[model samples]
Target: MLTIIPDLPDHIFGLRASGEVTKDDLQQVLLPGLEKLSEQYKEIYYLLVLETDVRNFTAGAWVQDLIAGIKHLTEWKKMAIVTDQKAVEKFTDIFSYLSPGEAKGYKLTELPIAIGWLSHKA
Candidate 1:
């Protein structure tokens, strides 16, 4: 499931994911939430925390994520992905190079630092 990460500034959009995050979660929760935030701001800071229990994404969910990302390609101002999973870390690292804004991956133990980094303005 996905839930907002609380206590962030207005321009920051954060979410914590655990368990099996399905296409419905992206459609019903994440994408719509980002869409709404996009309407409210020109640029958005994003924080995604994939807790250790998170399972693999469904095929459709991956497609949705790609679509949403392309739709808001320039909307991201900063992004931090917190996880200990190697594949996820590698993917985030690669995606970072293609992002318009700064993107970084942090170890699960560095979640606090990741939040702090995203919270700061570039």
Candidate 2:
């Protein structure tokens, strides 16, 4: 399941993912939010919180995410992922530096800090 985080300004979009995420979830929940943000802002700050309840993505879902990410690569200004998964943390730490947009990963406990950093002006 997925839920959009509330209380953020229009330019900031946040989503929390739990349990199994499928392509339909992306289509129904995330895509609409992204489209709305694209219409309202030149660039978007996206925060994704992946809790322990979030299981692995299905193959179709993973493909959709990759395509979406590539499509909006330059539209994103900042990406903050809050996850304590060791592999996820390591991957983000290693590759975020190479990404076009600023990206960072924080433990779930630091989600507020991640949100602050993503929403802050550079």
lDDT of candidate 2 over 1-122, digit per residue (tens): 67899987667889998888889888888888887887888676888899744456777778878877887877878888889897787777776787778878899999889978987855
Clashing pairs in 1: none
Task: Give the Å error, residue 109, model 1.
Answer: 1.4
**TM-scores of all candidate predictions against the true structure:** 0.90, 0.91
Model 2 spans > 4 angstroms off: 53-55
On lDDT, the candidate that comes out on top is 1
Of the candidates shown, which would achieve the greatest TM-score relative to the real structure?
2
Task: Report the C-alpha lDDT of model 1 over 46-114, residue by residue, as the tens digit.
Answer: 899998444567888788988988899988888888998878877888888888988888898998898
Q: In terms of TM-score, how similar is model 2 to the real structure?
A: 0.91
Q: In order, what lDDT does every prediction score?
A: 0.84, 0.81
